[model samples]
Target: MIQRFILLGEGYTDLYELFEIARTNQRRLLRLVQLDTVISGQKKSSLVVILQPAEPGKLMPLYLSLEGVYPPEEKETERYQLFEQLSHELDAPIHRLEVKPSADFNELELYFQYVIGVLRLNRFIPPLQ
Candidate 1:
């Protein structure tokens, strides 16, 4: 299966679009993740919506709004609240992880690769097949 992160945008107006994607594709929705990271002494989070692979293609698209919202543990935000609400509505627990900020990587693709490795190690996603 080819798992890829499809970044919508920073968690501004694009967050609503992410929610809609989860809501509309609830059946295909596999997991909701909150990636917590500290960037320059500020706690931030990335919201990810993991979907099952598509038929015939085996393409699993992971939708994400990277490092845009303040993690609810540190500060409650409307964006985080909506994500929580979506988790409740979907009956899927939000998987949280602490990770290095994207800025640490020389390129954005490297950052994503790191995240994929972490997810695979945690068994949140499947291993190589």
Candidate 2:
């Protein structure tokens, strides 16, 4: 199976789009994740929705709002609240994880590759098949 990260910018307007994807593809929803990263001492979150692989193509989509919201545990924010509401609506619990910031990589593509590696290692998503 091939998995790809479909980033939706930071967590502002994209929050609604995220909710729509989850709601529209509820059956395909596999897992919901919150990747928490600390960048320059500021805690931020990247929300992810892992979907089942496609039937014919076997392309697994990992939808994400990359580092969009301020860390909710540190300080409350509307973005975080939006995520919470979506999770509730989907009846899917958010899985939080600590990770390196995307800025650590010189290129955004490298950052996504790094995240894919981590996910595969953790078995959050299946490896190549």
Candidate 3:
């Protein structure tokens, strides 16, 4: 199986799109994750929706909404409230994790790989082939 991150946008405004993908692919929804990180002194969050591998290609999509909202635990935000609402609607609890900020890496690809590694290590996603 091949798993890859499909970035929606920096959580600024496109988080709704991520929720839409999950809602539309409810059957394929595997995991809902909230990646918390401190970027440039600001605590932020990245929301992810993992989907089961599809037939014919076996591509497991990991939809992402990059750091767009403040950490919900630290401070309440409309975005996080919406996420909680969506999780309730889907009956899937969000998995919250603290991780290194993307800014730590020189490139986003490296950051993605790092997150993938963390997910695999934590059993949030399948091991790499």
Candidate 4:
């Protein structure tokens, strides 16, 4: 299976689009993730929607709204609230992890590789075949 990260945008209005994807594909929903990181001395979070691999093609898409929202533990935001509600509605638990900021990486692809490694290590996603 080829798992790839499909970045939507920073969690501004694009968050709604993420929610819509979850709502529309509730059955295919595998996991919802909240990646916490510190950027420029401020705590922020990135939300990810992991769906099961597509049929025949074996392409698994990990939709992400990269670190743009404030960590809800520090401050409650409407965006995070909606994500929580969606979690309940979908009966999917949100997996939280502390991670290095993407800015720390020299390349964006490297940052994604790091995230994929973390997910695999935690068994949130499958290990390499």
What digit string (tens of lDDT, one per residue) describes model 3 on residues 1-129? Answer: 778999988654588888899999999899999999997778899999999887677798999998887877679989889999999999999998999989889999999999998999999999967
Q: Which stretches of candidate 1 lie over 4 Å from their true place?
A: none
- Tens-digit lDDT track of model 2 for 12-61: 66888887898999999988888999988989889998999767777899
Could you give candidate 4's per-residue lDDT for residues 3-111 as a string of tens digits?
A: 8999999755799899889889888899999999998889999999999976666888899999978888788998888889989999999999999999999999999
RMSD (Cα, Å) for all candidates, in order, is 0.8, 1.2, 1.3, 0.9
* CA lDDT of each prediction against the hidden true structure: 0.92, 0.86, 0.90, 0.91
Model 4, stretches more than 4 Å misplaced?
Answer: none
Compare candidates 1 and 2 on lDDT and give the better one.
Answer: 1
The model with the greater TM-score, 1 or 4, is 1
Structure candidate 4, residue pairs in collision: none
Lowest summed lDDT over 10 consecutive residues: which window, candidate 2? 7-16
Measured by lDDT, the strongest candidate is 1
Compute the lDDT for candidate 3. 0.90
- Residue ranges of candidate 3 with Cα displaced over 4 Å: 11-13
What local lDDT score does residue 83 receive in model 3, on the 0 to 100 scale?
A: 90
Greater-TM-score candidate between 2 and 3: 3
Error of 4 at 36 (Å): 0.2
